[model samples]
Target: MPEETPAGTPEGTSTARVGGTVDVGGLALTRVGFGAMQLERLEGDRDAAVALLRRAVELGVNHVDTAQFYGNGFVNEVIRDAFGDDDGVTVVSKVGATPDPGGRIPLRLAQRPEELRAGVEDNLRSLGLDRIPVVNLRRADSGPGLRAEGDQVVGLDDQLAVMTALRDEGKIGAIGLSAVSLETVRRALPVGVVCVQNSYSLVSRQDEELLRLCVEQGIAWVPFFPLGGSFPGLPKVTDTPEVLEAAKSLDVSPAQIGLAWLLHHTPNTILIPGTADPAHLEANVAVGSLRLDAATLRSLDAVESRTGDIVLD
Candidate 1:
Protein backbone atom coordinates (compact mmCIF):
# COMPACT_ATOMS: atom_id res chain seq x y z
CA MET A 1 0.00 0.00 0.00
CA PRO A 2 1.19 3.51 -0.81
CA GLU A 3 1.56 5.98 2.01
CA GLU A 4 -1.16 8.64 2.14
CA THR A 5 -0.35 11.81 0.24
CA PRO A 6 -2.16 15.16 0.09
CA ALA A 7 -1.69 15.79 -3.60
CA GLY A 8 -4.68 15.66 -5.96
CA THR A 9 -5.10 15.91 -9.73
CA PRO A 10 -7.35 18.35 -11.57
CA GLU A 11 -11.07 18.02 -10.90
CA GLY A 12 -13.27 15.64 -13.00
CA THR A 13 -10.57 13.11 -13.84
CA SER A 14 -12.24 10.80 -11.32
CA THR A 15 -10.59 8.22 -9.06
CA ALA A 16 -9.17 5.02 -10.64
CA ARG A 17 -12.53 3.26 -10.72
CA VAL A 18 -12.09 2.99 -14.47
CA GLY A 19 -10.56 -0.49 -14.21
CA GLY A 20 -10.59 -3.07 -11.51
CA THR A 21 -7.38 -4.53 -10.04
CA VAL A 22 -5.30 -7.57 -10.96
CA ASP A 23 -2.79 -9.07 -8.57
CA VAL A 24 0.74 -8.90 -10.01
CA GLY A 25 2.41 -11.15 -7.47
CA GLY A 26 1.14 -9.67 -4.13
CA LEU A 27 0.58 -6.17 -5.52
CA ALA A 28 -2.97 -5.57 -6.72
CA LEU A 29 -2.55 -3.19 -9.65
CA THR A 30 -5.36 -1.35 -11.40
CA ARG A 31 -6.00 -3.02 -14.74
CA VAL A 32 -5.73 0.35 -16.42
CA GLY A 33 -2.24 1.78 -15.87
CA PHE A 34 0.19 4.46 -17.03
CA GLY A 35 3.34 4.25 -19.16
CA ALA A 36 6.16 6.80 -18.85
CA MET A 37 7.68 6.29 -22.32
CA GLN A 38 6.06 9.47 -23.55
CA LEU A 39 8.17 11.37 -21.06
CA GLU A 40 10.93 10.98 -23.63
CA ARG A 41 8.88 13.05 -26.04
CA LEU A 42 8.59 15.79 -23.43
CA GLU A 43 12.13 16.81 -24.46
CA GLY A 44 13.52 16.60 -20.91
CA ASP A 45 10.88 18.64 -19.07
CA ARG A 46 11.28 16.97 -15.69
CA ASP A 47 8.56 19.03 -14.05
CA ALA A 48 5.95 18.27 -16.70
CA ALA A 49 6.81 14.56 -16.63
CA VAL A 50 6.74 14.48 -12.82
CA ALA A 51 3.36 16.28 -12.75
CA LEU A 52 1.96 13.73 -15.22
CA LEU A 53 3.10 10.77 -13.12
CA ARG A 54 1.73 12.32 -9.92
CA ARG A 55 -1.60 13.01 -11.64
CA ALA A 56 -1.91 9.35 -12.65
CA VAL A 57 -1.52 8.33 -9.01
CA GLU A 58 -4.12 10.91 -7.95
CA LEU A 59 -6.48 9.36 -10.51
CA GLY A 60 -5.96 5.91 -8.94
CA VAL A 61 -3.21 4.50 -11.10
CA ASN A 62 -0.94 2.32 -9.00
CA HIS A 63 1.00 0.55 -11.75
CA VAL A 64 3.54 2.50 -13.81
CA ASP A 65 5.73 0.85 -16.50
CA THR A 66 9.08 2.50 -17.06
CA ALA A 67 12.50 1.61 -18.50
CA GLN A 68 16.04 2.92 -18.13
CA PHE A 69 16.39 3.09 -21.90
CA TYR A 70 13.46 5.51 -22.11
CA GLY A 71 14.68 9.07 -22.65
CA ASN A 72 18.19 7.93 -21.75
CA GLY A 73 16.97 7.15 -18.21
CA PHE A 74 14.94 10.35 -17.96
CA VAL A 75 11.60 8.55 -17.59
CA ASN A 76 12.72 6.62 -14.51
CA GLU A 77 14.02 9.85 -13.02
CA VAL A 78 10.60 11.43 -13.48
CA ILE A 79 8.96 8.45 -11.77
CA ARG A 80 11.38 8.70 -8.84
CA ASP A 81 10.78 12.43 -8.61
CA ALA A 82 6.99 12.05 -8.71
CA PHE A 83 6.40 8.95 -6.61
CA GLY A 84 9.63 8.48 -4.72
CA ASP A 85 7.81 8.65 -1.38
CA ASP A 86 4.64 6.86 -2.48
CA ASP A 87 4.79 3.21 -1.52
CA GLY A 88 1.41 2.43 -3.08
CA VAL A 89 2.65 2.87 -6.64
CA THR A 90 4.20 -0.25 -8.16
CA VAL A 91 6.83 0.82 -10.70
CA VAL A 92 7.51 -1.86 -13.37
CA SER A 93 10.77 -1.33 -15.27
CA LYS A 94 12.66 -3.32 -17.90
CA VAL A 95 16.27 -4.34 -18.48
CA GLY A 96 18.25 -5.77 -21.51
CA ALA A 97 18.50 -2.76 -23.80
CA THR A 98 21.24 -0.25 -23.04
CA PRO A 99 21.88 3.15 -24.60
CA ASP A 100 25.19 3.54 -26.39
CA PRO A 101 27.58 6.46 -26.18
CA GLY A 102 25.78 8.03 -29.17
CA GLY A 103 22.55 7.90 -27.06
CA ARG A 104 21.06 5.33 -29.45
CA ILE A 105 19.96 1.81 -28.59
CA PRO A 106 22.75 -0.66 -29.27
CA LEU A 107 22.18 -4.23 -30.41
CA ARG A 108 23.82 -5.43 -27.23
CA LEU A 109 21.78 -7.74 -24.95
CA ALA A 110 22.47 -7.75 -21.19
CA GLN A 111 22.13 -11.46 -20.34
CA ARG A 112 25.17 -12.27 -18.26
CA PRO A 113 24.66 -12.29 -14.50
CA GLU A 114 27.04 -9.39 -13.96
CA GLU A 115 25.52 -7.37 -16.80
CA LEU A 116 21.99 -7.98 -15.49
CA ARG A 117 23.16 -7.05 -11.99
CA ALA A 118 24.41 -3.74 -13.29
CA GLY A 119 21.13 -3.18 -15.14
CA VAL A 120 19.19 -3.81 -11.94
CA GLU A 121 21.41 -1.36 -10.09
CA ASP A 122 20.83 1.24 -12.79
CA ASN A 123 17.06 0.82 -12.43
CA LEU A 124 17.30 1.09 -8.63
CA ARG A 125 19.39 4.25 -8.82
CA SER A 126 17.30 5.87 -11.55
CA LEU A 127 14.00 5.17 -9.76
CA GLY A 128 15.43 5.97 -6.33
CA LEU A 129 13.85 2.85 -4.92
CA ASP A 130 15.28 0.28 -2.57
CA ARG A 131 13.74 -2.39 -4.80
CA ILE A 132 11.65 -2.18 -7.95
CA PRO A 133 8.37 -4.02 -7.44
CA VAL A 134 8.52 -5.67 -10.87
CA VAL A 135 11.52 -5.87 -13.20
CA ASN A 136 11.04 -7.35 -16.69
CA LEU A 137 13.98 -8.97 -18.45
CA ARG A 138 13.20 -7.85 -21.98
CA ARG A 139 14.28 -10.27 -24.73
CA ALA A 140 15.84 -8.16 -27.37
CA ASP A 141 15.64 -9.30 -31.00
CA SER A 142 19.09 -10.77 -30.57
CA GLY A 143 17.29 -13.46 -28.55
CA PRO A 144 18.01 -14.73 -25.01
CA GLY A 145 21.24 -16.21 -23.59
CA LEU A 146 24.83 -15.00 -23.67
CA ARG A 147 25.72 -12.37 -26.25
CA ALA A 148 29.32 -13.51 -26.45
CA GLU A 149 28.30 -16.52 -28.54
CA GLY A 150 27.21 -15.06 -31.87
CA ASP A 151 24.15 -16.68 -33.61
CA GLN A 152 24.22 -19.62 -31.16
CA VAL A 153 21.35 -18.72 -28.82
CA VAL A 154 21.03 -20.29 -25.41
CA GLY A 155 17.87 -20.82 -23.34
CA LEU A 156 16.35 -18.43 -20.75
CA ASP A 157 17.41 -20.52 -17.72
CA ASP A 158 20.77 -18.75 -17.52
CA GLN A 159 19.03 -15.35 -17.53
CA LEU A 160 16.26 -16.48 -15.18
CA ALA A 161 18.89 -17.68 -12.76
CA VAL A 162 20.24 -14.16 -12.52
CA MET A 163 16.79 -12.58 -12.06
CA THR A 164 15.70 -15.10 -9.45
CA ALA A 165 18.91 -14.51 -7.57
CA LEU A 166 18.16 -10.76 -7.55
CA ARG A 167 14.64 -11.48 -6.26
CA ASP A 168 16.10 -13.46 -3.39
CA GLU A 169 18.53 -10.62 -2.68
CA GLY A 170 15.64 -8.08 -2.39
CA LYS A 171 16.65 -5.95 -5.36
CA ILE A 172 13.36 -6.76 -7.10
CA GLY A 173 10.06 -8.13 -5.93
CA ALA A 174 8.68 -9.93 -9.03
CA ILE A 175 10.18 -11.05 -12.35
CA GLY A 176 8.65 -10.66 -15.83
CA LEU A 177 9.68 -10.99 -19.47
CA SER A 178 8.95 -8.78 -22.47
CA ALA A 179 8.65 -9.83 -26.12
CA VAL A 180 9.08 -13.47 -25.23
CA SER A 181 7.56 -16.48 -26.93
CA LEU A 182 5.41 -19.20 -25.36
CA GLU A 183 8.45 -21.43 -25.04
CA THR A 184 10.26 -18.79 -23.00
CA VAL A 185 7.30 -18.44 -20.64
CA ARG A 186 7.16 -22.20 -20.14
CA ARG A 187 10.86 -22.30 -19.39
CA ALA A 188 10.45 -19.39 -16.96
CA LEU A 189 7.52 -20.88 -15.02
CA PRO A 190 9.81 -22.50 -12.45
CA VAL A 191 11.60 -19.19 -12.05
CA GLY A 192 8.42 -17.66 -10.55
CA VAL A 193 7.61 -15.26 -13.37
CA VAL A 194 4.68 -13.15 -12.25
CA CYS A 195 4.03 -11.16 -15.39
CA VAL A 196 4.71 -10.82 -19.14
CA GLN A 197 4.73 -7.59 -21.16
CA ASN A 198 4.25 -7.75 -24.92
CA SER A 199 3.29 -5.54 -27.83
CA TYR A 200 -0.33 -6.73 -28.06
CA SER A 201 -3.17 -4.62 -29.37
CA LEU A 202 -6.52 -4.86 -31.18
CA VAL A 203 -4.81 -5.54 -34.48
CA SER A 204 -1.71 -7.13 -33.01
CA ARG A 205 -2.31 -10.77 -32.14
CA GLN A 206 1.12 -12.23 -32.54
CA ASP A 207 1.34 -13.09 -28.85
CA GLU A 208 -2.01 -14.85 -28.61
CA GLU A 209 -0.37 -18.08 -27.54
CA LEU A 210 1.69 -16.36 -24.83
CA LEU A 211 -1.34 -14.41 -23.57
CA ARG A 212 -3.26 -17.66 -23.26
CA LEU A 213 -0.39 -19.14 -21.26
CA CYS A 214 -0.37 -16.19 -18.89
CA VAL A 215 -4.15 -16.49 -18.45
CA GLU A 216 -3.86 -20.17 -17.57
CA GLN A 217 -1.03 -19.51 -15.12
CA GLY A 218 -2.68 -16.45 -13.51
CA ILE A 219 0.23 -14.27 -14.53
CA ALA A 220 -0.19 -10.58 -15.34
CA TRP A 221 -0.11 -9.88 -19.12
CA VAL A 222 0.64 -6.22 -19.79
CA PRO A 223 0.18 -5.03 -23.38
CA PHE A 224 2.64 -2.20 -24.05
CA PHE A 225 0.94 -0.76 -27.17
CA PRO A 226 -2.76 -1.33 -26.59
CA LEU A 227 -3.54 1.36 -29.07
CA GLY A 228 -1.82 0.72 -32.40
CA GLY A 229 1.30 2.85 -32.19
CA SER A 230 1.92 5.53 -34.78
CA PHE A 231 4.90 3.64 -36.14
CA PRO A 232 5.06 2.97 -39.86
CA GLY A 233 3.73 -0.34 -41.26
CA LEU A 234 1.64 -0.94 -38.14
CA PRO A 235 -2.11 -1.32 -38.52
CA LYS A 236 -4.05 1.51 -36.91
CA VAL A 237 -6.94 0.50 -34.65
CA THR A 238 -9.23 3.04 -36.30
CA ASP A 239 -8.49 1.62 -39.73
CA THR A 240 -9.61 -1.86 -38.74
CA PRO A 241 -13.13 -2.56 -39.89
CA GLU A 242 -14.27 -4.30 -36.73
CA VAL A 243 -12.75 -1.65 -34.45
CA LEU A 244 -14.30 1.15 -36.47
CA GLU A 245 -17.71 -0.50 -36.46
CA ALA A 246 -17.53 -1.04 -32.74
CA ALA A 247 -16.43 2.54 -32.15
CA LYS A 248 -19.36 3.88 -34.16
CA SER A 249 -21.91 1.62 -32.50
CA LEU A 250 -20.46 2.18 -29.06
CA ASP A 251 -20.24 5.95 -29.62
CA VAL A 252 -16.59 6.13 -28.59
CA SER A 253 -13.31 6.77 -30.30
CA PRO A 254 -11.52 3.93 -32.07
CA ALA A 255 -8.79 3.95 -29.45
CA GLN A 256 -11.36 3.55 -26.69
CA ILE A 257 -12.89 0.60 -28.47
CA GLY A 258 -9.47 -0.96 -28.90
CA LEU A 259 -8.60 -0.57 -25.21
CA ALA A 260 -12.01 -1.85 -24.12
CA TRP A 261 -11.55 -4.92 -26.27
CA LEU A 262 -8.23 -5.66 -24.55
CA LEU A 263 -9.78 -5.32 -21.06
CA HIS A 264 -12.54 -7.75 -22.02
CA HIS A 265 -10.23 -10.00 -24.01
CA THR A 266 -8.50 -11.32 -20.93
CA PRO A 267 -9.06 -10.92 -17.22
CA ASN A 268 -5.33 -10.90 -16.53
CA THR A 269 -4.50 -8.37 -19.22
CA ILE A 270 -3.37 -4.93 -17.93
CA LEU A 271 -3.04 -1.75 -19.96
CA ILE A 272 -0.11 0.73 -19.84
CA PRO A 273 -1.00 3.22 -22.56
CA GLY A 274 1.47 6.14 -22.50
CA THR A 275 0.37 9.72 -23.11
CA ALA A 276 1.91 13.06 -22.22
CA ASP A 277 -1.34 14.98 -22.66
CA PRO A 278 -3.52 15.07 -19.56
CA ALA A 279 -6.72 14.83 -21.57
CA HIS A 280 -5.41 11.84 -23.49
CA LEU A 281 -4.29 10.26 -20.25
CA GLU A 282 -7.73 10.74 -18.72
CA ALA A 283 -9.37 9.37 -21.85
CA ASN A 284 -7.17 6.27 -21.70
CA VAL A 285 -8.07 5.56 -18.09
CA ALA A 286 -11.75 6.13 -18.88
CA VAL A 287 -11.56 3.32 -21.48
CA GLY A 288 -12.56 0.95 -18.74
CA SER A 289 -16.11 2.26 -18.99
CA LEU A 290 -16.54 1.41 -22.69
CA ARG A 291 -17.79 -2.14 -22.78
CA LEU A 292 -18.06 -4.17 -26.00
CA ASP A 293 -20.92 -6.53 -26.64
CA ALA A 294 -20.54 -10.15 -27.62
CA ALA A 295 -21.26 -9.43 -31.26
CA THR A 296 -18.57 -6.74 -31.36
CA LEU A 297 -16.13 -9.11 -29.78
CA ARG A 298 -16.96 -11.77 -32.35
CA SER A 299 -16.47 -9.30 -35.15
CA LEU A 300 -13.16 -8.29 -33.71
CA ASP A 301 -12.11 -11.91 -33.47
CA ALA A 302 -13.00 -12.42 -37.10
CA VAL A 303 -10.88 -9.48 -38.17
CA GLU A 304 -7.90 -10.83 -40.04
CA SER A 305 -4.88 -11.23 -37.76
CA ARG A 306 -2.15 -9.14 -39.37
CA THR A 307 0.11 -9.02 -36.36
CA GLY A 308 2.63 -11.28 -38.05
CA ASP A 309 3.74 -8.51 -40.36
CA ILE A 310 3.95 -5.89 -37.65
CA VAL A 311 7.44 -5.68 -36.16
CA LEU A 312 8.09 -4.65 -32.58
CA ASP A 313 9.29 -1.05 -32.32
Candidate 2:
Protein backbone atom coordinates (compact mmCIF):
# COMPACT_ATOMS: atom_id res chain seq x y z
CA MET A 1 0.00 0.00 0.00
CA PRO A 2 1.16 3.57 -0.61
CA GLU A 3 1.82 5.94 2.28
CA GLU A 4 -1.24 7.56 3.77
CA THR A 5 -2.05 11.14 4.73
CA PRO A 6 -4.07 11.92 7.83
CA ALA A 7 -7.83 12.07 7.28
CA GLY A 8 -7.95 14.60 10.07
CA THR A 9 -8.52 18.34 9.85
CA PRO A 10 -6.62 20.21 7.11
CA GLU A 11 -6.09 23.77 5.92
CA GLY A 12 -7.33 25.41 2.71
CA THR A 13 -7.28 28.80 0.88
CA SER A 14 -4.54 30.29 3.06
CA THR A 15 -2.11 32.62 1.28
CA ALA A 16 1.05 30.93 2.48
CA ARG A 17 0.33 27.43 1.22
CA VAL A 18 -2.04 25.37 -0.92
CA GLY A 19 -2.09 22.00 0.81
CA GLY A 20 -3.06 18.57 -0.55
CA THR A 21 -6.44 18.74 1.22
CA VAL A 22 -9.33 21.16 0.75
CA ASP A 23 -12.59 22.01 2.55
CA VAL A 24 -15.34 21.91 -0.06
CA GLY A 25 -19.05 22.30 0.40
CA GLY A 26 -18.95 21.72 4.20
CA LEU A 27 -16.81 18.64 3.64
CA ALA A 28 -13.00 18.27 3.87
CA LEU A 29 -11.92 16.59 0.64
CA THR A 30 -8.45 15.87 -0.68
CA ARG A 31 -7.45 18.27 -3.43
CA VAL A 32 -7.15 15.20 -5.69
CA GLY A 33 -10.51 13.37 -5.54
CA PHE A 34 -11.66 10.31 -7.49
CA GLY A 35 -14.21 10.33 -10.31
CA ALA A 36 -16.03 6.97 -10.69
CA MET A 37 -17.28 7.36 -14.28
CA GLN A 38 -14.77 4.84 -15.61
CA LEU A 39 -16.05 2.12 -13.34
CA GLU A 40 -18.64 1.53 -16.05
CA ARG A 41 -16.05 -0.53 -17.87
CA LEU A 42 -15.49 -2.87 -14.92
CA GLU A 43 -19.03 -4.26 -14.82
CA GLY A 44 -18.04 -7.77 -15.94
CA ASP A 45 -15.84 -8.09 -12.87
CA ARG A 46 -17.43 -5.91 -10.23
CA ASP A 47 -15.01 -7.15 -7.62
CA ALA A 48 -12.21 -5.46 -9.52
CA ALA A 49 -14.05 -2.17 -9.52
CA VAL A 50 -14.76 -2.54 -5.82
CA ALA A 51 -11.09 -3.29 -5.23
CA LEU A 52 -10.08 -0.18 -7.15
CA LEU A 53 -12.41 1.98 -5.05
CA ARG A 54 -11.06 0.39 -1.88
CA ARG A 55 -7.53 1.12 -3.07
CA ALA A 56 -8.43 4.77 -3.72
CA VAL A 57 -9.74 5.13 -0.15
CA GLU A 58 -6.65 3.31 1.09
CA LEU A 59 -4.55 5.99 -0.63
CA GLY A 60 -6.32 8.71 1.42
CA VAL A 61 -8.96 9.71 -1.12
CA ASN A 62 -12.20 10.64 0.61
CA HIS A 63 -14.07 12.51 -2.11
CA VAL A 64 -15.72 10.44 -4.89
CA ASP A 65 -17.89 11.69 -7.78
CA THR A 66 -20.44 9.43 -9.45
CA ALA A 67 -23.70 9.46 -11.39
CA GLN A 68 -26.64 7.04 -11.56
CA PHE A 69 -26.49 6.65 -15.33
CA TYR A 70 -22.86 5.53 -15.43
CA GLY A 71 -22.88 1.90 -16.60
CA ASN A 72 -26.67 1.90 -16.33
CA GLY A 73 -26.34 1.79 -12.52
CA PHE A 74 -23.49 -0.75 -12.51
CA VAL A 75 -21.05 1.89 -11.37
CA ASN A 76 -23.19 2.76 -8.38
CA GLU A 77 -23.59 -0.93 -7.57
CA VAL A 78 -19.83 -1.26 -7.34
CA ILE A 79 -19.69 1.93 -5.32
CA ARG A 80 -22.43 0.54 -3.13
CA ASP A 81 -20.48 -2.67 -2.59
CA ALA A 82 -17.04 -0.97 -2.27
CA PHE A 83 -17.06 0.36 1.26
CA GLY A 84 -18.29 -0.37 4.74
CA ASP A 85 -20.56 2.04 6.59
CA ASP A 86 -17.66 3.65 8.46
CA ASP A 87 -15.64 4.36 5.32
CA GLY A 88 -15.52 8.18 5.15
CA VAL A 89 -15.75 8.89 1.42
CA THR A 90 -17.80 11.91 0.42
CA VAL A 91 -19.94 10.90 -2.61
CA VAL A 92 -21.00 13.72 -4.95
CA SER A 93 -23.36 12.61 -7.73
CA LYS A 94 -24.96 14.28 -10.76
CA VAL A 95 -28.59 14.40 -11.85
CA GLY A 96 -30.21 15.51 -15.20
CA ALA A 97 -29.84 12.16 -16.94
CA THR A 98 -31.17 8.62 -16.59
CA PRO A 99 -29.85 5.23 -17.61
CA ASP A 100 -30.82 4.11 -21.12
CA PRO A 101 -29.17 0.74 -21.59
CA GLY A 102 -30.21 0.50 -25.26
CA GLY A 103 -29.72 4.08 -26.41
CA ARG A 104 -26.83 5.03 -28.67
CA ILE A 105 -25.63 7.12 -25.74
CA PRO A 106 -26.03 5.51 -22.33
CA LEU A 107 -27.83 8.52 -20.82
CA ARG A 108 -30.66 10.75 -22.01
CA LEU A 109 -31.40 14.10 -20.40
CA ALA A 110 -33.57 13.96 -17.28
CA GLN A 111 -33.99 17.74 -17.24
CA ARG A 112 -37.57 17.92 -16.07
CA PRO A 113 -38.15 18.62 -12.36
CA GLU A 114 -39.71 15.19 -11.82
CA GLU A 115 -36.88 13.44 -13.65
CA LEU A 116 -34.31 15.24 -11.49
CA ARG A 117 -36.13 14.05 -8.36
CA ALA A 118 -36.32 10.50 -9.69
CA GLY A 119 -32.62 10.69 -10.58
CA VAL A 120 -31.83 11.46 -6.95
CA GLU A 121 -33.97 8.55 -5.77
CA ASP A 122 -32.33 6.24 -8.30
CA ASN A 123 -28.87 7.29 -7.09
CA LEU A 124 -29.93 6.79 -3.46
CA ARG A 125 -31.47 3.38 -4.10
CA SER A 126 -28.46 2.08 -6.07
CA LEU A 127 -25.84 3.63 -3.76
CA GLY A 128 -27.87 2.65 -0.65
CA LEU A 129 -27.86 6.12 0.79
CA ASP A 130 -30.65 8.21 2.24
CA ARG A 131 -28.74 11.41 1.72
CA ILE A 132 -25.88 12.03 -0.70
CA PRO A 133 -23.23 14.47 0.50
CA VAL A 134 -23.61 16.68 -2.58
CA VAL A 135 -25.68 16.38 -5.78
CA ASN A 136 -24.88 18.48 -8.87
CA LEU A 137 -27.67 19.42 -11.27
CA ARG A 138 -25.95 19.25 -14.68
CA ARG A 139 -27.53 22.14 -16.58
CA ALA A 140 -26.56 20.98 -20.06
CA ASP A 141 -27.29 24.58 -21.02
CA SER A 142 -23.78 25.20 -22.34
CA GLY A 143 -20.51 23.43 -22.91
CA PRO A 144 -20.19 19.88 -24.27
CA GLY A 145 -22.30 16.77 -23.70
CA LEU A 146 -26.06 16.13 -23.51
CA ARG A 147 -27.92 19.19 -24.78
CA ALA A 148 -31.57 19.76 -23.75
CA GLU A 149 -34.22 20.13 -26.44
CA GLY A 150 -38.02 20.70 -26.70
CA ASP A 151 -39.84 19.81 -23.44
CA GLN A 152 -36.53 18.69 -21.96
CA VAL A 153 -35.62 22.36 -21.58
CA VAL A 154 -36.85 22.76 -18.02
CA GLY A 155 -36.50 26.14 -16.36
CA LEU A 156 -33.57 26.46 -13.96
CA ASP A 157 -35.81 27.74 -11.17
CA ASP A 158 -38.17 24.76 -11.53
CA GLN A 159 -35.28 22.28 -11.24
CA LEU A 160 -33.84 24.18 -8.28
CA ALA A 161 -37.23 23.99 -6.58
CA VAL A 162 -37.15 20.17 -6.54
CA MET A 163 -33.42 19.99 -5.66
CA THR A 164 -34.12 22.44 -2.90
CA ALA A 165 -37.00 20.24 -1.81
CA LEU A 166 -34.69 17.24 -1.74
CA ARG A 167 -32.24 19.17 0.43
CA ASP A 168 -35.06 20.30 2.69
CA GLU A 169 -36.34 16.73 3.08
CA GLY A 170 -32.78 15.44 3.72
CA LYS A 171 -32.27 13.46 0.51
CA ILE A 172 -29.12 15.41 -0.47
CA GLY A 173 -26.70 17.27 1.72
CA ALA A 174 -25.82 20.23 -0.55
CA ILE A 175 -26.52 21.40 -4.12
CA GLY A 176 -23.99 21.90 -6.96
CA LEU A 177 -24.03 22.99 -10.60
CA SER A 178 -22.41 21.21 -13.54
CA ALA A 179 -21.73 22.29 -17.15
CA VAL A 180 -23.25 25.71 -16.54
CA SER A 181 -22.25 29.18 -17.73
CA LEU A 182 -21.12 32.14 -15.60
CA GLU A 183 -24.54 33.76 -15.95
CA THR A 184 -26.25 30.49 -15.03
CA VAL A 185 -24.14 30.21 -11.91
CA ARG A 186 -24.95 33.81 -10.98
CA ARG A 187 -28.68 33.18 -11.33
CA ALA A 188 -28.46 30.04 -9.17
CA LEU A 189 -26.44 31.75 -6.43
CA PRO A 190 -29.56 32.46 -4.37
CA VAL A 191 -30.07 28.69 -4.03
CA GLY A 192 -26.76 28.41 -2.13
CA VAL A 193 -24.74 26.27 -4.50
CA VAL A 194 -21.83 24.60 -2.78
CA CYS A 195 -19.69 23.57 -5.77
CA VAL A 196 -19.30 23.93 -9.56
CA GLN A 197 -18.19 20.99 -11.76
CA ASN A 198 -17.15 22.21 -15.18
CA SER A 199 -14.56 21.12 -17.74
CA TYR A 200 -11.50 23.16 -16.77
CA SER A 201 -7.75 22.62 -17.00
CA LEU A 202 -4.50 24.49 -17.63
CA VAL A 203 -4.97 23.92 -21.38
CA SER A 204 -8.62 25.01 -21.48
CA ARG A 205 -9.06 28.34 -19.75
CA GLN A 206 -12.49 29.30 -21.10
CA ASP A 207 -14.09 28.88 -17.69
CA GLU A 208 -11.53 31.10 -15.94
CA GLU A 209 -14.15 33.75 -15.28
CA LEU A 210 -16.56 31.20 -13.79
CA LEU A 211 -13.72 29.76 -11.73
CA ARG A 212 -12.85 33.20 -10.36
CA LEU A 213 -16.50 33.74 -9.50
CA CYS A 214 -16.55 30.42 -7.63
CA VAL A 215 -13.46 31.43 -5.65
CA GLU A 216 -14.93 34.83 -4.79
CA GLN A 217 -18.20 33.23 -3.68
CA GLY A 218 -16.54 30.58 -1.47
CA ILE A 219 -17.76 27.74 -3.75
CA ALA A 220 -15.59 24.71 -4.40
CA TRP A 221 -14.58 24.44 -8.06
CA VAL A 222 -14.36 20.68 -8.67
CA PRO A 223 -13.49 20.43 -12.36
CA PHE A 224 -14.50 17.40 -14.40
CA PHE A 225 -12.64 16.41 -17.64
CA PRO A 226 -9.45 17.93 -16.28
CA LEU A 227 -7.85 17.71 -19.73
CA GLY A 228 -9.75 20.38 -21.62
CA GLY A 229 -10.65 18.74 -24.98
CA SER A 230 -14.10 19.96 -26.13
CA PHE A 231 -12.97 23.28 -27.56
CA PRO A 232 -11.45 23.49 -31.05
CA GLY A 233 -8.27 25.49 -30.38
CA LEU A 234 -7.32 24.24 -26.88
CA PRO A 235 -4.77 21.41 -26.70
CA LYS A 236 -5.12 18.41 -24.43
CA VAL A 237 -3.46 19.24 -21.12
CA THR A 238 -0.74 16.56 -21.34
CA ASP A 239 -0.02 17.47 -24.97
CA THR A 240 0.59 21.14 -24.12
CA PRO A 241 4.27 22.01 -24.70
CA GLU A 242 4.70 23.98 -21.48
CA VAL A 243 3.04 21.27 -19.38
CA LEU A 244 5.24 18.62 -20.98
CA GLU A 245 8.33 20.77 -20.37
CA ALA A 246 7.35 21.33 -16.76
CA ALA A 247 6.74 17.59 -16.27
CA LYS A 248 10.22 16.76 -17.61
CA SER A 249 11.81 19.45 -15.44
CA LEU A 250 9.99 18.26 -12.33
CA ASP A 251 10.72 14.55 -13.04
CA VAL A 252 6.98 13.75 -13.31
CA SER A 253 4.52 12.89 -16.06
CA PRO A 254 2.87 15.61 -18.14
CA ALA A 255 -0.50 14.54 -16.76
CA GLN A 256 0.77 15.07 -13.24
CA ILE A 257 1.94 18.55 -14.19
CA GLY A 258 -1.48 19.29 -15.64
CA LEU A 259 -3.26 18.16 -12.50
CA ALA A 260 -0.75 19.84 -10.19
CA TRP A 261 -1.02 23.15 -12.03
CA LEU A 262 -4.75 23.21 -11.27
CA LEU A 263 -4.10 22.98 -7.53
CA HIS A 264 -1.43 25.67 -7.83
CA HIS A 265 -3.58 27.95 -9.98
CA THR A 266 -6.72 28.07 -7.85
CA PRO A 267 -6.88 27.86 -4.08
CA ASN A 268 -10.46 26.53 -4.15
CA THR A 269 -9.99 24.17 -7.10
CA ILE A 270 -10.59 20.43 -6.45
CA LEU A 271 -9.82 17.75 -9.04
CA ILE A 272 -11.70 14.44 -9.64
CA PRO A 273 -9.67 12.58 -12.27
CA GLY A 274 -11.02 9.07 -12.92
CA THR A 275 -9.58 5.82 -14.30
CA ALA A 276 -10.35 2.08 -14.39
CA ASP A 277 -6.74 0.84 -14.26
CA PRO A 278 -5.24 0.35 -10.81
CA ALA A 279 -1.89 1.87 -11.81
CA HIS A 280 -3.62 4.86 -13.40
CA LEU A 281 -5.85 5.29 -10.35
CA GLU A 282 -2.79 5.36 -8.10
CA ALA A 283 -1.09 7.93 -10.30
CA ASN A 284 -4.16 10.15 -10.34
CA VAL A 285 -4.42 10.00 -6.54
CA ALA A 286 -0.67 10.57 -6.20
CA VAL A 287 -1.05 13.96 -7.94
CA GLY A 288 -2.22 15.35 -4.61
CA SER A 289 1.43 15.59 -3.52
CA LEU A 290 2.94 16.75 -6.82
CA ARG A 291 3.95 20.34 -6.09
CA LEU A 292 5.12 22.69 -8.86
CA ASP A 293 7.62 25.51 -8.35
CA ALA A 294 7.18 29.25 -8.95
CA ALA A 295 9.07 29.14 -12.25
CA THR A 296 7.08 26.17 -13.56
CA LEU A 297 3.81 27.73 -12.43
CA ARG A 298 4.69 30.95 -14.25
CA SER A 299 5.53 28.97 -17.38
CA LEU A 300 2.25 27.07 -17.30
CA ASP A 301 0.37 30.29 -16.58
CA ALA A 302 1.93 32.06 -19.57
CA VAL A 303 1.07 29.21 -21.98
CA GLU A 304 -1.37 30.71 -24.45
CA SER A 305 -4.46 29.30 -26.20
CA ARG A 306 -7.59 30.54 -28.00
CA THR A 307 -10.91 30.16 -26.12
CA GLY A 308 -13.18 31.29 -28.96
CA ASP A 309 -14.94 34.31 -27.41
CA ILE A 310 -14.04 34.17 -23.70
CA VAL A 311 -11.70 37.02 -22.64
CA LEU A 312 -9.71 35.95 -19.58
CA ASP A 313 -9.95 38.10 -16.47
C-alpha lDDT of candidate 2 relative to the true structure: 0.81
lDDT of 2 by residue, 120-166 (tens): 99999999998999999988866556678999988989999999999
Across 144-226, the per-residue lDDT of candidate 1 in tens digits comes to 11133543243577788888999999999999988777887898898888889877787777788888889889899888767
Q: Write down the TM-score of every candidate.
A: 0.87, 0.89
Error of 1 at 216 (Å): 1.1
lDDT of 1 at 94: 86
**Model 2 spans with C-alpha error above 4 angstroms:** 1-19, 100-106, 230-234, 307-313
Highest lDDT against the true fold, candidate: 2
- How many clashing pairs in candidate 1? 1
TM-score quality measure for candidate 2: 0.89
